[model samples]
Target: MTRSMCRTRRAGKSAGVVAAALMALAACSSSSDSSSHRATGSAPELSGTVTVFAAASLKESFTALGREFQRQHPGTKVTFSFNGSDSLAAGINAGAPADVFAAASPKTMAVVTDKKSTAGTPATFVRNQLEIATVPGNPHKLSALKDLTASGLKVVLCDRTVPCGAAAEKALAAGKVRLTPVSYEQDVKGALAKVELKEADAALVYKTDVRSAHGKVEGVEFPESARAVNDYPIALLKNAPNAAAAKAFIALVRSAEGQKVLTGAGFLKP
Candidate 1:
């Protein structure tokens, strides 16, 4: 009776061992199935949001490009914070969660570089020249920076801290002209907006802005602008959450596809 009982116990242990082996085999099979599914490009998709802080003048073109990028990368969303180049640089330096940054001038970009906020060297993606923007029909006949100094002319200029304003000062100095503006606007858009609203007779702004404004303002080209050309620099932020997407977006802006759009909207390829 004791021998028979021992044999039964041994058989039960054998069955338990077999069950453990089978369970392990099943887990291995499921793992392999999952790996095969991923190998066949059935893995979960890549998707996320990226934040870009850009110069104020880039508002229109960058917004359009952001839309195009979304169309290309369906799962990615782009949010832009557009403001003065100096202000944007300050935000990034202060640890803003920016995936990318685009500035109107290298001077402003230097702030990011100095703070080590840029992932790599910022590239010159585009260039812009200054233009005198006035109300439709050439009411002021303000075709040049010198025209701003004429009596009864209400000229608006970007603040000295802003890139556009610095460029304007350089052009004015180069042209040997001095004029007092009605207001020193905080940004180029603000200066241009003043002209659009008829708050000022003339304003110095990017030529691209005048084009974007359409019937809102007429653009006047001056030769002095040649000396004050502003370069647009773009870079992926060092702490970017979506570094891959940021790089792809920057590549697109430097690509021929981007150049076409930028030029059409009045930006010169650098």
Candidate 2:
């Protein structure tokens, strides 16, 4: 072969090799992008029912959040079981079918995590403070933590094992007030219900719970509540029936829109 022809042929072969290398790199880049998208859940459009066992205090806000999540995810369904955080945690430990667990207190959430029932570290999405929930119009003019101790004023409180009860106790202790309740209820809602149904003159419950009652109950914020704040934590279950949906639901709860709803319902941002 002529020298010039040989040089051209060699150069052509080198060009082909470089082109092949570039193509291989492009293919690798595309594969990596796809993998990253999957890992981070690009689009995150999820389906299936995500069963969430949440604290009673979260009933109203979480129900609203669930509807918004379904609206955003189209086919995803969020079903919730709301009760005392301690009770829900116990149910989880007993092999309950739950995709996610949102507790009103870290202690309750620890019940699930300590049992190795969580797929990820729990996140504190909100904090709540206790308030005196009294009957509409405050006939007794109940205004402070100490007011519950008034003579003949029937009061109800959450059981000490629950978050609201724990916070109420702390607040009362901080204010140096001693109260004898007519009943110790299982959850914040139940405590608030005591006032709404007139079963008791007042109940120390979460500010959020009283707000959800929409005037059926009136809320009285006490200074001692600042010391008794409770953090609400959430996590996906280790054996979540719909892991992807559970993750998406949690993301929504931590989102700004979710915070707006929660704050509107009187939950403080974490």
Candidate 3:
């Protein structure tokens, strides 16, 4: 063949190969686009806010759980109001709007259920026992529930209506130890604060609270605590503004991952 004709044929072959490569690239791009669209539509889209009224003791674990819930359900937010269980129940009964309620004790949870503030049966997620929270380094060397009775020692207790208070009362009575506290706080965290701030030598609180406090306070476990183990109950509020998100939150709390977080924070599995 002539040299020019040979060169022309080679150029045509290269052009044809380039055209085939472009068509293959276009086909793959079209397939990927369709798959991306289907995946986007199939994935559940959750948005809005879920308000949770939880006990003071659950602040740490529930807060972590809420964050993980938000991670799994992007565009959703979890807002929590942590307080004394009895106080939260009263607020719910008084028509405070909340998507979920988690109480430190079943007795306190009953307050909300009795008022018909819950949609279904409350599930026990975890349990806690009373422990003495003392100032870091145990300045008073408070050993047991009875140690709070030492004269000149300023002790704080939870109010009779609070879950921690109720448990503390039961444990004290079981031990037959009677001592007047200098102050009666409304929530477990308040009682812990007294010890943390050095306002009180010791306070009866949940184990989880002491754990949450890190180095601010130290926990001293007592055998009498066995007499009043508190069960933490959670339920979906009636007519929750974000019912779907609330349900998802509760499911996460009951799921293995949630239990892992709770147990890591020193909560006993229910």
Candidate 4:
């Protein structure tokens, strides 16, 4: 090998090494940029109003969860319509504009699902039992389901169409106690209000409602309630305008943090 040839070969080897290094550096930079782009676009930004039609029984806990969801997602808003599950289901079936539906019972939930108004199968998230909501301090000393049967006890009850009313009837039947109510309110909250306002001596309501009352009424638990526990189911509406936010809200309700708020509000885990 001549000296000149040796020098040329050495120079060629140096160029090859430099070229490889440059290619490696370019590849690294390209990979970094691609990763940065993916990182920025990985999560789609969630923004919109999520309208929820929920049973009155879920008002307290769901409201808290809604606030938490909005906080976690700054650009999103949660609006809730709290009412009798039956009524809410009817509205949904009638093409009401709602993102989510949380019913007090599977029966009520089916009213929408059977109509094919829901996006998917409903999920039971919690259970609730009946309690006799009496005036603060239990002036009548109503201890059991039978006590509500006393003559002249101005007792109120939810109408038979609503979940609370249906549960109340189940509990009543379980106790084998026959009683006529002064009035059958359209919803549990209405029945509970009768007790809170001292209009009714006692009303068959949910344990959660009595607790949410914050001393406005007293709660009486009966063994019959165990047989009449109601299951709460939630689902996304097929016509949900804000599907993404609605799904997120449902996820939150089924999440540990959501369950914590619900359990803290006297609801039983599913």
Clash number for each model:
0, 0, 0, 0
List candidate 2 segments past 4 Å from native: 1-44, 117-119
Which should have the higher TM-score, number 1 or number 4?
4
Residues 35-131 of candidate 3 have per-residue lDDT tens digits of 5655889634568999999999888778777876776666899999999988888888888899999999888888888866355689999999888
lDDT for each residue of candidate 2 in 88-167, tens digit (9 for 90 to 100): 98888888899999999998889889876354689999999888888888999977787888999999999999999898
- Pull out the clashing pairs in model 3: none
Which regions of candidate 4 are displaced past 4 Å?
Answer: 1-39
User: How would the candidate models be sorted by TM-score, starting from the highest?
Assistant: 4, 3, 2, 1
lDDT of each: 0.80, 0.80, 0.81, 0.82
- State model 3's lDDT: 0.81
Error of 4 at 76 (Å): 0.6
Question: In model 3, what is the error at residue 83, expressed in angstroms?
Answer: 0.6
At residue 61, give the lDDT of candidate 2.
74
Top-down lDDT ranking? 4, 3, 2, 1
Model 3: CA > 4 A from native:
1-44
Over 4 Å off, model 1:
1-46
lDDT by residue for model 1 (197-252), tens: 99888899999889778679888998999999999999889899988788878876
